[model samples]
Target chain A: MPEKTVTDERLLELLASEFTFEQGFALLVSAYKQRLYWHIRRIVITHEDADDALQNTFVKVYKGIAHFEGKSKLFTWMYRIATNEALSLVQQRSKHAAGTLDGNNSAALLKADPWFEGNETQLLLLNAIAGLPEKQRLVFNLRYYDEMPYEEISELLGTSVGALKASFHHAAKKIEQSIRAI
Target chain B: MSKNTGQELEELSPLLRQMREKGDGLEVPHDYFDDFDKNLKQRLTERGVRRHALRQIPVAVKRRIWPGLLVIAASLALVLGAVRHFNTGNEPAELAVLELSADDITAYITENAADFEPEQLAVLEETPDAGNQSPAPEAGKATPEKEEIPVEAVEEIIDEMTDEELAELF
Candidate 1:
């Protein structure tokens, strides 16, 4: 999946001093839409919600670009934002489903649904991941689904490498527990 | 602990190999990545379009650059105005009083005389019509009613104060 679009040269040039928020914004959306959407989907578990959250994330990035300090990588920043969006969605769902259901219960609910057409391993993985706590769930998705390194995840989440390693360790244990249960 | 230190563990390899398999329960259609790529690129393009739309917003009213510039300009203007006002406060008429004292005034008057009466001397600075340059008044009849230094008084002072004396005084 080695895909490179506008080089930093053209990207910067297209985004040079003349960049009206228009071209730069368009280029950014073109570059990141799908990656962000899938990242959101992996966490949030609904295509429609993922779509909405993705659009909202892009809009947020578009509006906030002026404040972008460029100290971190753009993708890392974007991944952070997308991660936030997904977590926020989950938080909202948590609020709605609060005492009635926790993440594991909700995962069970979604898992039990007959309409789920996903492959068995994916369902198993999702079920196992769903059984994990929210932070651990996000860590697992980033490490496993998005195939992101702890270093990048650390940068995005502003956590220390040691803490992330611990988190990933705990998450892997939980997911393995779920898989073994399956 | 599932946190295997070495890649020697068979778990990760089996899982990855399993994920690659069609029946392993993660069978994304062949088009999944393609769709993901397309969707992502589309999102990125949408973002680009949004940025383009945002750029279309006129920059004249932008707060980041223009407002800051306006504030700087206003600050400079205020500073300039203050400097000018303080400079005007130090103008000649207002400043002249600072240079005057009773001794300087008496010295200016004692060295010369052109028959100015005591009344005229009393009203020397009040001579409203004496120093009228538009028309010459009678030599001694002109009242000291305006800001006028009489020509005869000037002449007498010039005569009494020789060029050397003037130089020495200066």
Candidate 2:
């Protein structure tokens, strides 16, 4: 027999109910894990950080499930949480680096990472992106890599669509300048 | 790239266009997502069990503890109420007096006048003394003197005043 599929509403209903909560949550994790992992990976710039952030995001979602008001799409809400967790991890890493003699360079870290398959050109592009301010970097990544629409990105970041567009434009200009310098 | 200043990079620069075409180059271990759910479930289960253990107190202990907790809560409430009562001094008693009827006030004054100061008794006695006498000649029939106001009516006006107004009056 074919596996049964559940709608997001039905899944949420099951999650809220005592009998089916665990199974519903497991289904929810499986559905979004890969997408969320990549989204996090793009921001934090490493698989390990992405993994930690992803786990933290899921744990938070599980704990806060009862408070989920269903005002937004489940994925949008989860994306917001994932984004926060990723940014928080980056903030921690930045703090740690600021304390050390050698500041933590994510570009160098990415280049050294065995899992990264990008060539020299890709590395240059990534380094250029890494030079961006946090908000601009996020705007660039979500726009360039994820191809997320400005409206959805606006909802996710609580930023205006016009501001997001401006950030992306500035980010692109900066990246081009960085790439030329490289 | 330097030659193309002010031109749109997406259109002018092949590298910029290529970078856009070629997405972020991140990878994961083979079949990572396949086992990710199982691993997450294990962690969640372990966490759930840990949380459950923390939440699970012995019913016998709870039964014993509840009476002690209730006693403590009652003691706290009593302490707080006494503190509030003392803090407000005689305001509550005055409010209670305001709620009493004219007959009740007369009876209270008759019983408790000995306990009160002469000045306090004079304030209480002024109401009935004025009511028994005829109205003053200069006074309009429509507007009674403040002394001619019935004790009940005076109390009603005081009762209508908010706490701030009452505080301001005192």
Candidate 3:
């Protein structure tokens, strides 16, 4: 049988009830895990790191969901968590690779990733995006890849729409320049 | 925030439009998403066990643990006092515990069975002779007598408890 769609309101209700919490959590994971995985994958640049960040994101959500007062959309709240986890993983990885010979080379990491099916040009674009500053990289991914609205992006990132637009513009320009140089 | 009209990309950078056409080119292992929640369930369960293990003693159990120890301590003190009163010579107090028969000890415990309590019974049920049993609380149900410990205080205790301390707690 086809499953009935669970709305965010219904999800929150299910989560609030102790008896139905696991059921609601399952539905929540089924709903957002793929979307979140791709979003995290874009930032962390590898399946392994993305998986780690995604798991941590869900764990955080489980711990903090009770405090979520429904001030923002549930998707936005979860996206914020996924973004933070992805960035934290990147930071930790960079710290680990600081003095290593291989270093935290995203391009090399992407090429080595068994699941990355990109051609040379696609690889170059990903590499270019990876090279952008953290804020610019995040802005570009949410805008260019996910096609998330500027308003939603702003809400998730706690940045102004104008600043996000500007960051996206600079990110796109830098990525284009990087790809052109190669 | 405005809708992500495609026009923004063209005005921002033509190269980005072309790159989008090339796609992100990411893939997952076969059935990755299908198994993701199952794997996540396992992780969550493991986490639940760890957190539950940390809160091994409920507030009721905390209040009760000391009473069991006191009963044992008081019984030993009374036994020593009786031994000292009877044996004027320095025969040593250790011989009193040694002198008692298995039946005598069993009868004493049977007489005082009311003092053993459910929490101590739970510990004995879990470990017969191992002397170390899990101190996991009674299925996490709070009775009226449960004195709720603040979560911060529980966290503080969790941080300070070593393996030996945790074992002894059970």
Q: Note the chain A TM-score of all models in turn.
A: 0.82, 0.89, 0.92
Tell me, by lDDT, which candidate is best: 3
B15 Cα displacement, candidate 3 (Å): 2.1
Model 1, span B1-170: residue lDDT tens: 22333331135445533543332132233555456535645666665743422222223223334666789999999999999999874553323423444345345556543444565465544533333543666688864343444544444434544555444444
User: How would the candidate models be sorted by lDDT, starting from the highest?
Assistant: 3, 2, 1
Q: Compared with the true structure, what per-residue lDDT tens digits does model 3 show for residues B1-170?
A: 37564678777777779779778788888988888887877888888822111112223333545677799999999999998888776553334333443344335546655655665445433433211222435666653333332333233333444554434333
Once fitted onto the true fold, the runs of candidate 1 whose alpha carbons sit more than 4 angstroms away are A1-3, A16-20, A99-116, B1-170
Q: Name model 3 segments beyond 4 Å from true.
A: A1-4, A99-104, B1-5, B49-170
TM-score of each: 0.52, 0.58, 0.62
Give the docking tier of candidate 1.
incorrect
Candidate lDDT values, in order: 0.58, 0.69, 0.71
All candidates: interface RMSD: 8.6, 12.1, 10.1
Better of 2 and 3 by TM-score: 3
Ranking by TM-score: 3, 2, 1
